[model samples]
Target: MQTNSSAKKSKHILGLVIVDGVGYRNFLLSDFVNQSLNTFDEVVIFSGLPSESFEMQERANVSIVELPVFQESGKTWFWRKAKEVAHMQLHKYNFAGIDYNLQKNYPITKTKRALITKMIFRITSVFHSEKWINRFYRNQVSSFKKDEVTKVYSELLKREELDLLFFTHQRPPYLAPLDYAAKKLGIKTCSFLFSWDNLPSKGRMAAPFDSFLVWSDLMKKELHFFYPETKKQPVEVVGTPQFEPYVLDRYTSSKEDFYHKFELDPDLKTICYSCGDASTSKNDPFYIEVIAKLMEQNKLIEKVNFLVRTSPAEDGSRFKEVNKRFSFIKWNYPKWELTRKDHPEPWSQRVPLPEDLKDLRSFLKYCNLNINMCSTMSLDFMLFDKPVINPTFGTGENDLYDDQKYLRYSHYERVLESGAVAIVKNEEELVREINFSLKNPEARLKEQKELLELQIGKPLKGTSQRIAENLNEFSKA
Candidate 1:
């Protein structure tokens, strides 16, 4: 593919890659697309989802291109897994989250492929230098280019005359070819660190971009700490677009309207129990039952309404029996749609609808208290100045993958130290914390603000505009 630099005089086109549902929510569903269009001559969204899934009418100077499903070859997969294992081994002692993941995933009586991966990782760990890590990353990158996807991206980048390529989520391995093509064509590339726990807990990044955009200065520091090579690259601390809707007027609804929509009682204080995915918090049903039973037995200090918001990444069918048992629990099932049923990673193909955004915003705004198993929703509630309680009770097995272990992860350390949230270990503490939080909603106000500042590193408003301004500046350079 030929470069379009000579054909175009001054037209600056930006290519934004959306790798997953969260990316769709953060970029396309937010004000980001409009903001980018305002700053650039044109914007092209290269989405991992099908174009039909968006249900959006294409506007002038903007196009949405659906990416072909990325098929990883066996060799590519092996190297990628090897790199991840080596990275986990390298940082296991530094971050407890990495250590936990390593201990859990390490091959014991697993498949032959797993055993070979472990063997290769052991050999790689013998060297374990930053140089070795970079080599492993480069090998993975090279292996990805062996496929036809690189050519596809090369053609797309050249055809669009894209001056800058930005990845909404940095961790998906499918992004490697696109990143490679951008680099080969000399287009500037930048990747957003997806979540708070991504850098420390998630394995090696799929590809190395020219720069990185992070949620906070703390995250920027984390990026440099985990990938020291990124230290020399530009790391912009623009607060994430994920929480922008919390402050947006259009996403908000009146208290009465919100209560009526969910059949919530306006007279009672609402305690929202936000559930993580099935894999992350399998004990969510048990937690919900405990809360329901507390309300059933009238053990609480005051009668408050219970609201359960299931994870958008999953269907909440698992809570059917619990919902049936607890009639009073107002359930807000997420409105995310499954776009590609045949996709290998079904979770990635799930796309969030715009209505869900409004529903989520309302839930955060009007809910008096929030409860979860150490989720980012805690930060969302904190942004609203609402009290939060993290229930960390497992099945008392004390084995690996216990829900209780999440509190000790590296990312949650700041949360624990902040004293902004109540961490309950058992039903007794859970009852006490929930009642106390409802009674004194402003008890942790100061700490919550401090923690938000530490996590977000920017004012809540205009985060999308900030990101756009940065992207425009990067495109021009």
Candidate 2:
């Protein structure tokens, strides 16, 4: 780590980069921006969102800059895809999720792109060393820096005179030029690992940084295991601000208010079913039907109010038929807007509304039990000491995408071992587990605490402050 002695004596400027809705929610919507402003002289946010849609409470010593659109050449695209395939080939044997994604994405197809990608995979598989992976990564980064976007970002950074560049998410391909520009201008850079499963299942990051911010020591170990090159860089475990809203008073609503707003019976216990995106959990409607039918038949131990919160990454139109059939199931569509309609990826363009934070917090606070395939909502509900039920009822061999395989992934193995949540494989097990959980919500309280501690190293109350302090310390190192 290089120490900036001048930064300690003079004003320090922090450049915060947010590329998507999740990042916007985690950093700008949280206390991270306020904490950073308190630590640094000025805080500039380089955002991928449109200026009109960048909704945040204005503050002094804070500004927002719209990032330029990155245009990728054919060579850069080829190198990027090749690097992803090569990385999966290198570690597919160790990570089941990576193996599944590799097999599912690049199968024996007849398309020209698939054929070319497979050929790249084969050639890279021969030289399956970390050295070769680094070579591929360098090729992609070098190719990306040649674009005009790099010059635009370089000029912006120069004008801002940034002491440190911080990235909220590390995997967006569009961020390569910004990262490269920061490094080119001799500015310190840092990135936060996006999610627990990102290191093992996702491919290589867009670029390397001087420091890394992770959620736990477990994630730090995983980073070293996957990318040994990061051993020399500082990896700080500051925890994530995603669950901080659960403890914040502003994001909470009274149970009566929540029930009345959602138009649900206050007498019945609430069971929330959080849906995955369209590609990850295509059979969510089937699962919804199973629970609704059980509720209709009076098969459960008690009558309960059912709520479904669809993924913010996708619209809820896919569940229109199911919603119509199960009129009893209350729907809580996430309040996320598509700010950038022309963006290549629709998921990246969706930004959550600030009001959704209160709604989500209320849902987590009041829900008696949460049901999903394999999601981080398990952690969120567990944060509130609520029971969670994960249903894996389909076979990968027969189904288009296997929800069961998620149970065997490297990141999820700890959840299974901790026994913090019930894993129900079939409808009978799901019914039995739901009944058991309702009867004994605190049965796995100890395990949930252990799992939460193991996954989230730092306390959740001051996560944003901790992260900001670490960034300031790293800047002055």
TM-score of each: 0.96, 0.96
Task: Write candidate 2's Cα lDDT for 227-324 as tens digits.
Answer: 89899999999999887766777787899989997888999998899999999888788889999998998888999999999999988999999999
Task: State each model's CA lDDT, in order.
Answer: 0.86, 0.87
Model 1 segments more than 4 A misplaced: 1-9, 395-401
Local error of candidate 2 at residue 356 (angstroms): 0.5
Query: Which stretch of 10 consecutive residues in model 2 shows the poorest summed lDDT?
Result: 1-10
Model 1 per-residue lDDT tens digits across residues 162-230: 889999988788888888988888899999987999988878888878988899999999999888988
Q: Any runs in candidate 2 off by more than 4 Å, and if so which?
A: 1-10, 107-109, 398-401
List pairs with backbone clashes in candidate 1.
none
